[model samples]
Target: MSSELAEIEGQISDIFRALSNGFQKMDKIKDLNRRSRQLEDLTDKMRESKRLIKEFDREIKESQYKFDSETTKLLNEKKQSMIKELNSYVALKKRYASNIDNKRVDLFEGPGDGYAEENVMLASTMTNEQLMGHGNHLMDETDQAIDRATKVVHETIDVGTETAASLKAQTDQMSRIVNELDSIHFSIKKASQLVKEIGRQVATDRCIMALLVLIVIGVIAVIIVKIVNPNNKDIRDIPGLAPPAQSRRLLWHQD
Candidate 1:
């Protein structure tokens, strides 16, 4: 009977040992499962980060491409406008110079042949001093003709001088106008450059704003997903179930 009791006791001890070992293995399996879940969550977070980075890269590239296209278009427009204006100014200057030249030529031209013919007729009609007595009268007529010719010559010289002075004044005015046109051209160029710079800055700012908006939207989406799916406890929820602070900082830095 004692041997039977001892055998029963040994069997009970073996059963207990086997049960303890089973419990330990079950605990170890549970721990392994928890660690695996954590690794999976970390992997998901890493994937999300990679996806966001790719999105940001794509957005930045697109923004840069848009800015470049707009800048090129603006530059072309400005160049065409400036060229047209300069051409107009040049044409005007040419027309004015041509008109001035024509007027000068007309004003300084020689007298007609009618005056010469009249002088020849008068000389023919004059007697060798119809009598030496009329010689003085012929001399007086000759002197009067000389005086008239001198007066005509003097008047022509005065007219020519006045015309020359007028031409000179016009030339000086044209020169001044040309200088003003040059100044205007320079100012226009500067203005175009400034506008280009401002446009670029505005484009850059818009890009930054778009990036910020995307980041904010992403953050909101993450929050909504966390709130809607209670079981989906992602590592991103560590900071009050919001997006990672590092991501926000990165977005700011990109901006």
Candidate 2:
């Protein structure tokens, strides 16, 4: 009985150990779940970052386009204004020259003192010279303006090219980030699968452990029953135990 008790005690100990192992595994599973959630959060953050990057890229492109459009519009307006000013200057110069020619003819033909005519002719010549100088100055200013405008346009184009290069670099960086995200997603998926597999294995182990515990309990119960019911005829006889002999009564005969 003591031996049987010891055996049962051992089985109970084994059951306790199994339960401890199961608890440990459960803790591991909980840890895995926690890590999985953390990975999911990280993935969400990465995606958000990527979205922000794309938004920023779009804004930059829009700003660049707006800048280019405004610059071109201003340049075209300035060019047109310059052209109109030049045309008006040429028309005024032609009218002034025709008026000076008529005044010279009248000064020569009309009755006038020689000194007065000389003064008139001299004044007209001085006016014409001043007009010519002014026109030359206007031409020089126009040429300078054109050069400056061309330089500005070239600079704007260079800036645009640089901006495009920068955008390309940013796009490349985004691509790299996307690739890294893909790899991270793959890793997370693999980890989740591994966790699931572990859970399945643990469940299987738990079921096996429960069956083993039931078997142990059944064995202990049978041993206890056998120990408690000594009169059970089904119990096997022990070696060296003989059957009881029938007693014969001796009677004395009367004479």
Best by TM-score: 1
Give model 1's TM-score versus the native structure.
Answer: 0.37
TM-score of each: 0.37, 0.36
The stretch of ten residues in a row with the least summed lDDT in candidate 2 is 246-255
Candidate 2 deviant stretches above 4 angstroms: 1-132, 226-255
Candidate 2 global TM-score: 0.36
Candidate 2 residue-wise lDDT, 119-171, digit = tens: 66765777777868867986998899899999999999999999999999999
The C-alpha lDDT values of all candidates are: 0.60, 0.58
Q: After the best TM-score superposition of candidate 1, give how far the Cα of residue 190 lies from its true spot, in angstroms.
A: 0.4
Error of 1 at 161 (Å): 1.3
Candidate 2 has an lDDT of 0.58
User: RMSD for each model, in Å, please?
Assistant: 53.9, 38.8
In angstroms, give how far residue 72 of model 2 lies from its true place.
60
RMSD of 1: 53.9
